[model samples]
Target: MELTYLQTFREIVKWGSYTRAAEQLGYAQSSVTTQIQRLEASYGAVLFERYGRTMRLTMAGEALLPYASEMLRLHAESKEVVSKQSAGALTIGTIETLAAFFLPPYLQAYRRDYPEMKVNLQPGNEPFIIEAVKEGTMDVGLILDPPLADPELHTVVVRKEELVIAAHPDHRLGGLAAAQVRDLAGESLILTEEGCTYRAMLLRALKEEGVEHQLSYEFGNLEAIKQCVVYGLGVALLPRIVVEEELRNGRLKAVPFSHPSCEFYTQLIYSRKKWMSAAFRDFIALMRGGRGEASKMHE
Candidate 1:
């Protein structure tokens, strides 16, 4: 009956664990359990069932999911309609690379425009961000990926982000006019963890070209991957924006490489069903204006 209980249920589904959801919501595990129990009582249906070590949504839970999302969305809409507030919270789901290197200046300018607005930059992989946008959870999502069209969401290509293969200054492949897939054969590669969009692109391209390379290291953190490349552990595929400073400082070299499959973009996505806020439109406008130039940045 309580909206907060529904919120908890959604959080549980998002996190896939009672304890994890509780931590995310800043509630005790017992409190989360009690809230879920109350939610179940109101519906008179078991929401979750244990499948081995994981808790999975039961048939009833699957049925309630959409209604719960719609109710929460409407609740948010009601507040927006009634208050007509000049400033409020805006959550943007994005990936770590964009959060670290790409979004700060745009966000800073946005803050200057809406100083009272609370901007929550939620970081996740591309797929998770897309799903969160569709679910009405994130106000908008910025993802580095190939251009994709979804009926449930409005997609905008903010910029075509160039992916590059980074190597140390002393590496054998350095100073070449350009590197091709053929050049990658037998080379040791330091890769991002499995889900990275560019990483997948690179692996797929290599597989198609029959290029065999060593997977020397797999790091989730971009900085770690850069550091390893700097030490000559191996070359890595990453966005050009991320390694700009290193390349300028003579630490890393961008192997001249560009392939059709590896081309990704900084894309903006928002649900077609959700009402767009003024702040949301302004943020997208700023992104389209230009990426804050690196030389102008103080950070």
Candidate 2:
């Protein structure tokens, strides 16, 4: 009956655990249970079932998810439609690399104008960011990945970013003009965590080429991987933007590795059905990096 209940219900569906949903929504577990109970009473159906250790949506819950999603979307739309456009809050989901290397300048510029705007930068994997954007929880999703296609969200290719192999300046591969897949045979590779898009592409290409690689170290942090590479630990595949400073300063060298599958881009994503507020429009326009748009945001 209450919009809060539906919001909580959808959060439960997203996380698949009462505790996790509660934590994410900033509600106590008991409060989450109570909201679900009230929602079930309103609908006269059991919404979830215990499945092993986690929760699974019941048939009734499954049927209600789309409706709940729609309700939330419309609720958000109405707020945007009626509220004064001051860019009150903008939530962005992105990966660590982009969060650290790519977005700071843009955030600084945007905040300079909309100093009162509440901006939440939620760092996450590509898939999670996409889903958050689709669900209307995140107002925008900024990611560095290959082209994405999804009916529920609008995708924009901001720019193509070269993927590079980063290595210590003194490493053996540092002298290569361009390192081919075969050139990396038997080399120790430091890589990002499993959910990384470029990491998957790199591994797959190596596998297809039947190039044997030594996985020396795995890390979730870009700086950690770069630091490891600087230690002569191993070469790491990362966005050129990420290693630009290190390469410029002689702390790291670009190994000149090129792979078609590893090609990626900086992209923007937003829900297709959600309303875009004036501030939201300005933010997107600003990200488009057009002279006209950049000028508008400052004005």
Candidate 3:
């Protein structure tokens, strides 16, 4: 099958509409239809199922998705290699909180030292970031305590971040130096979305301690969570780095919590088999507070 056909198929799957995919690919509607027909005719399997106005992927389409993605990735890499376009270009994936609080200084320092390098930062949940690294779509991933043990990936611990229960200054638990999980039983808890690593840890701690509480609000954005807490909506468990400014400004109070899971590590991770370019190596070294030999080249 042609690469353009595979690309068209992937775009159709992403948009869930043939017309939308055609619009995005700058192809006439008939061309998209003909391409899909040719692709299905060659494979002898139906790729997509049409139900009136809606379209959904068939079993064949589901099976083809991963291979299509891999082929596209390899094609891009080959072009980069042939054109020598990969150097000085780094793509990193990370979680939202780290993108906000932890990465700024290190990124600034790296840019100052290697002004010729180009950095692209993409933020998502832990699994999304890890998958991007594994697929070679991202050069590296910075995540918070990824739970899975993948033999293909190597992880380096960057730092352990302390988690604390944060609330408005007027909250009753605000004055405590440290509080037990059970202490939050009667309180309303503001939480991040389900995929958040720290949120998962916090829930596990409460469950193990037999503390039942109400989830007052669930937010996907860290700033929104902080704002809700500041307005006395609820107490939330958050990384200290995320709340440092609010804590210092007296807008929020971080009460240290008594739990083993209160501390989670930030890790820099990448595929073990992936080639380490000088730029990638230098970035990893910067994150680890080590100046690798690559640093001397740019100097």
Candidate 4:
């Protein structure tokens, strides 16, 4: 069957009227009717049933809807893939933290390695980045651990990041050399939005231990949260890498939790069904190099 006829059928089903579909497609209403007629004739069944001025799908059309939608989607994706390849673009998605601190030098090296390849980076939280990869919105993802039940997605733990509790230099908690997870009770705590994977894990730990604390402030922006902690508003639990500068400059004090240090796993995830392009492979290789190979490298 011709692809254009299937497209015409989709437009008619979407708009519910042949005239409206034709108007949207910039074709005559009679042309839309002819296409539907040709499609029905080829299948030997009526695809639509007239109801007043509108049309509804028949059993045959209903059965074919999913396949037709998938075919149209694949066709659109094919065009996109071709366009990206011709333009030498490689799209990578990750969270704001990594995109800000970790990925810059690596991306620069990637460009140095492949000057012809254009790199496109999209930054979001873990869930958003994972969904982008799954939906083919991104070609590759460097995300924090995504809780995916599907076995088709490959997740490789590139490194372990310690979740550190930080506070202002003169805060009461700063006097304690170390803190147990239970010691945070009755204190003001700053946190990220609930969609953050780390925030979810921290909240789960709090619930499990029944530790009660006042949530003084919450920010979707990590940098803003760090600034709040630095300014002595409240303590916050964040990945060590995120606040390394603050710690080094004595602007923030990191309180270690000994009993059960909340360690988060950072990963490079990509779709199993996706064919990794050459540019993507190069970028991944740069990330997985020896501990001291790159300036941002850490054990």
Query: Judged by TM-score relative to the true structure, which candidate is superior, 1 or 4?
Result: 1
lDDT of each: 0.86, 0.86, 0.83, 0.77
* TM value for model 2: 0.90
lDDT of the structure predicted as candidate 1: 0.86
* List of clashing residue pairs for candidate 4: none
Residue 97 Cα positional deviation in candidate 3, in Å, after optimal superposition: 0.8
Q: lDDT tens string, model 2, 36-117?
A: 9999999999999999988999999999998898887788778767877774678899999888988999999999878878
Question: TM-score, each model?
Answer: 0.91, 0.90, 0.82, 0.69
* lDDT by residue (tens digit), candidate 4, 41-70: 999999999988899999999987767766
State which candidate has the highest TM-score.
Answer: 1
Best-to-worst TM-score order = 1, 2, 3, 4
- The residue ranges of model 1 lying beyond 4 angstroms of the native Cα positions read 52-54, 290-299
lDDT of 1 by residue, 267-292 (tens): 88888887766666677677777455
Where model 4 places Cα greater than 4 Å from the true spot, the runs are 1-87, 146-150, 258-261, 290-299
